[model samples]
Target: MTSAPVTQPLPPQVFPPTLREVMLRPRWIALLAFSLVVAGVLAWLGQWQLGRAVDTSPPEPGLTEVVQPLDQVVQPGDYLPEPLVGQRVEVSGTWVASDFIVVSSRFNDDVEGYWVTGQLRVAGAAAPTSIAVAAGWTSSLDAANAAADELERQVSADPTAVVQVTGRLISDEGPSVPPSGADPLTITRMSPPMLLGRWHDTAELNVYRQYIASQTAIGPLDDISSPAPDERSRVNWLNIFYAAEWAIFAGFALYLWYRLARDAWEKEVEDLEDEQAEALAESSTSSSATGAAESRG
Candidate 1:
């Protein structure tokens, strides 16, 4: 008998690539490079924030305690520097008695009170210059008003008298809005701009952007409770937290690329399985029909 010809074996189909393999494709690699660029920019911004959050050259301890001239420390209309906010400064000026006003909501050692504020026309300036002064603090509103009235009378009696004041120079407590139905004359903050509005002879007046919290009260009120500023820490926890957030964002960028590639690979695998199933079903139907036709013949 003739030998049966050897049946040729069909070649095996190539296995589909894994998710990692899909990620290595040129298109996905380009996307990875773009993500790297974005991450780099975010990291740079985080580093910038870190640099600004801490003070590298803090002033010496008790530097603000040493007395200095008001003009030497800061000029009229100039903003006070942080290191000089509570600086002990000496200034010569004449008090505008009528300009003494009462400011409510003053706090002294956690106690809510009031402040009797005044305008001191700085002495020896070529033009008219003034600085706001929180003369004293009191618990009762009537007491605050009485002190202001007395100070006004004293300044009026000696309008030309030059007085020398030594106190801690401070930045202005910018103006605030009064309560909805509060009195028009009621003020609650030691704001130089607000005091200037109520000051007389303000034509061409040059005013200090900062103010003074006098160590000695002008009348019967108690001294203000302004303590020394605490030394700042070198390490900024907030900046560190922000840096961590940026690092997380960077990691997310890479993870996004991996996820997209994995999704695409999974879809390809599903389609391949569907195509193979359809081919098998068609082949089965063909075989059944051929056998049926032969049997009928």
Candidate 2:
């Protein structure tokens, strides 16, 4: 019987290329792009944080020396200029004790408690404005009441004391409501709605525009002054941290793309080499068979 005709085995076929394969075939290019984008974003966030850190102004000096009447210096519709943000100002007023409201979540140096807010009637102004002087906090309602009573007694006993109150002028924190069963007097802090509920006529006062004028003491008592506006402007670094994390993820995505593309390219090259080798082997065998047939003829 004639020997079966010799034939070379066929090489495995290659799959069609994809868009992703062409785009990220080069690992270095992908890596470079990824690093640049990540660095740019991180640098931007870092600069923003640095700007925030430097944007703040130092606390104004000579607050006591530049004391002026609160009503004269500011009006209901007027904005307190940046220069006066934390300045100590003097107002001659009689305490309107009956209008006191308990603000929740007030704290002293050591204890968490409530703020006893009251209206201060300027010596000559027809309308009284609200002011919040942080009274000492107590853990219980009874203690808060005791503190309120003490403040009331002090105001009543010394109505004509011509109290020159000095404190940092802070914008009113609008009211809020606490969960049911939460006591405003004993709770550490509460929202604006809860305080408004206790008011006979919430509309009487411009609650939205009112501010907390910290009372250092019943008299011009000494304490640390309020913080400067610039100090409050420091950019939150956590935002930068979040940006950095995003950049890292972007870099990782780029890395994954590059790795997959490189692996696919190497596989394609190997397949092509194998096919070429098989084609050459088949051609060589065909030529040798033709030569032997010609000699027989």
Candidate 3:
């Protein structure tokens, strides 16, 4: 007598995890927490930026002489009012070590020399903003390089050290290409974009069009003599520009979270669709095989 064959039970239906379900996963949850922290920090920084964007009351005459906060005097990406070109501003930031570069043909009191410059990553700004700082001046190229090296060493040793630099907010000397047969890396002007090109960790860097001539040099360097500008421009748009940055930053922070979630959801949906297709294909093949076997019987 032939024994009856036992049929195997069908496997339970497989369903893809919903977006909400995927987000609730421990891995995604942890990621969400991290994003939230980042967003919160950005929000706070944007708020800080807002407080300085557009000073409602125009700076009275002689504002140039009064040491104003860097953010109060000019926002990153805004032109320094021509009159505020010689404004004495106090900037708080940490030096970006690898960004210390030597710029040639700087004149101090009409004496031509080299200037050691560095990128000053602004303090308390969530945005990756920086200001070019002419750290010191030297008549000798060796001295300029040495000063730049020393500053880099000091920054690497204590990367987070925040230093306050009081300086004249001078307009950028537009960048110039190296002269014929000159070293390709040679930078002749105090241009932020020029210096930024040589700077490390410059991804998404926001820099001031104007640079700072430090009142005193750092680490074995001579001070940069910055005489006041002959004229100043009228208008106070610094605060207004800064406020706009804050709004953009805040919106970006929230968008980042949504983007991450949406990307994950999209990836999950694709995976689910692929899995469902595979299952259908396998089921169809099995049915075809079973029908063929019965027909042959």
Q: Which residue pairs collide in model 1, if any?
A: none
Candidate 1 has a TM-score of: 0.83
Model 3: how far residue 169 lies from native, Å: 0.6
Candidate 2 or 3, higher lDDT? 3
Candidate 3 lDDT over 1-297, as tens digits, reads 533333333435677677788778787788778877777776777666666554546557776888989998889899987557789999899998888899998898899999999899999887999999888999999989888888889999999999999999988889899988999999887788788777888788788999999998888988988876554343336755766676677677667766787788898888878887787778777767766666666
- Candidate 1, after superposition: displacement of residue 297 in Å? 3.7
Worst 10 residues of 1 by lDDT: 2-11
User: 42-145 in candidate 1: lDDT tens per residue?
Assistant: 88877887786677888888988888999999988999887788999899899987898999998899999999998999999989999988899999999999
C-alpha RMSD by candidate, in order: 4.0, 7.7, 17.4
Q: Model 2, 162-232: lDDT tens per residue?
A: 55566656554554446678654433343333444454444566432434445463422223234444434
Give residue 134's lDDT in candidate 1 (0 to 100): 88
Order of quality (TM-score): 1, 3, 2
Better of 1 and 2 by TM-score: 1
Give candidate 1 regions above 4 Å deviation.
1-14, 75-79, 124-128, 179-181
- Which model, 1 or 3, shows the larger lDDT? 1
Query: For each candidate, what TM-score against the reference?
Result: 0.83, 0.50, 0.57
Which residue ranges in model 2 land beyond 4 Å of their true spot?
A: 1-97, 102-115, 121-129, 135-164, 169-187, 190-193, 208-216, 219-236, 246-250, 256-260, 263-297
- What TM-score does model 2 achieve against the real structure? 0.50
